[model samples]
Target: MMKEQWVKDLSTIVNPQDVKIDEPLKNYTMTKLGGNADVFVMPSTEEAASEVVKYAHLHKVPIFLLGNGSNMVIRDGGIRGIVLNLSKLDQIRIDGTTVYAQSGALIIDVSKAAAAKSLTGLEFSCGIPGSIGGAMAMNAGAYGGEIKDVIVSCKVLTPTGDILELSKEQLELGYRKSIIAKNGYYVLSSVFELQKGDQETIDATITDLTFKRQSKQPLEYPSAGSVFKRPPGNFAGKLIQDSGLQGKGVGDAEVSTKHAGFIINKGNATASDYIDTIHMVQRVVKETFDIDLETEVKIVGEDLPTDKNKTL
Candidate 1:
């Protein structure tokens, strides 16, 4: 249980209204399945965010920085300490051919901003649902373009609350991983360098990618996109589909028939259903093809007690 005094103390660092106790986390994530966060804090400014992080560190409470929750699953038993949501800090600005985006700014929105300025190189991320912070943490990429290609530098808050500016090389961006993730650093903002381009050409590229995504991916249902990372020299989706695991599910969680890479919440699905389905797919793929499927989706929090005969 969260201590009342501890909850009240958070108000000293952030607005009282922004601090919540036993806050439901399901409302925050894409899948909309989870219990509660013992302490949920939303700071609208970088200064306030830093203060909160520092206070949590000083108090020895566990802290998790949450973005738009586009690629995560919070387990059924909920999160124990602080869950810092950066959604309120969204901001974006354009200067010449460079884009300055706050961590909370959506990547899709940033891509759109670049297009509006007639800047090229960001059209690839026009459909990604994640925020800049999450994108930086995972080196998020799509349609042959990754954040590393455009990012000039980033501002981040260290776990101990010190701010640092990291260049692209310093970020150590890789396929679905970065130094921010390895060190649990909190991204504050980023600068993306682009180039002047014809508006017609940029618009055409975005249109093409959007069509490809809508046609191939299952956007109608709720899911943490691309459940598993691509194994070296192989695609996770192809392996699952070839292994005949399509449409397989536990309860209401199903491997998307449209795209095998996705696991969708088929309405009334529990976190357990999603996890169990993931394990089932992994086990089947490994046994059938002898290739391991590593999860790309971030799974956090705790699970409900194992039920010998669980229902729903």
Candidate 2:
């Protein structure tokens, strides 16, 4: 199908206002970097979302799901085909000690909601920056807690646009991995099992975690949180710091001096620069400690085409 015809059909099913052509994805990313999306679609309802999923499948068009734009970096050439963002579907509901959150709702917000009801078990997630979908996809963890501990079940869309409610056991969650990530399933919403706890205690824990995260992480600049995953029995930041790689990177990107785990966008940095900086850190860390650093952040999209006329 032609781009114009498919996009028009897409707009007809979902709201036209929710559809965009050649939309710059940089504005949606946490790092404020990325190229344009061929066709950006934000469906406010599950019905519309499913329709879009089927549409893409029927048309044999490529589809990519975007959550809150955390923990990912899109290259400069942008994404082709349909880029689905569920930001408009954000909704959170609380019933007793159970928290139900849509994929687009921020995990941090759900943590706050749980706290407001004097619930526990999610205190460790108060500072997690990704959406619920992303959290589920990655089995996101912080401090001493992980998503697998509290997740009861979740609604997900299969690659063929079929919806299923899966239990925690079915999720097959592992360290920074899940069945959803493994199979490319699209998250819709999730139910979490929390416990009633002392309001004062919950508040205190959140405060302490928030303070530590703020004081230690370079949150002022645009970054995709930690650039590399923690190696077994070792820390990525310690390795980068020990390698003397702090405060150095490619072009406008830099390995944050305040937090070596972060690669910050020092204004107008391209995705290529950020990726190269990550490679540099990996190479140095491997050379110094013989440890192969693996990236935690997901990198996607394509590189900008080089101009033949430009002199190297």
What ranges in model 2 sit over 4 Å off?
none
lDDT of each: 0.92, 0.94
Q: Please, what are the lDDT tens digits per residue for candidate 1 over residues 1-312?
A: 355766788888888999999899999988988889989999989999998889889989899998999999889999988999999889999999989999999999999999999999999999898999999999999989999999999999999888999999999998899999999899999999999999999999999999999999989988998899999999999999998989999999999999999999989999889999999999999999999999999899988777889778
Residue pairs clashing in model 1 are none
lDDT for residue 39 in candidate 1, whole number 0-100 = 90
Residue 95 alpha-carbon offset, candidate 2, angstroms: 0.9
Alpha carbon lDDT at 304, candidate 2: 83
Residue-by-residue lDDT tens digits, candidate 2, 1-312: 466777899998899988989999999999999998899999999888989999999989999998888899999999988899988778999999889999999999999999999999999999999999999999999999999999999999988888999999999999999999999999999999999999999999999999999999999999999889999999999999999999999999999999999999999899999999999999999999999999999999878898899998
Please give the RMSD to the true structure for each candidate, in Å. 1.6, 0.8
- Among all candidates shown, the one with the greatest TM-score: 2
Q: How many clashes show up per model?
A: 0, 0
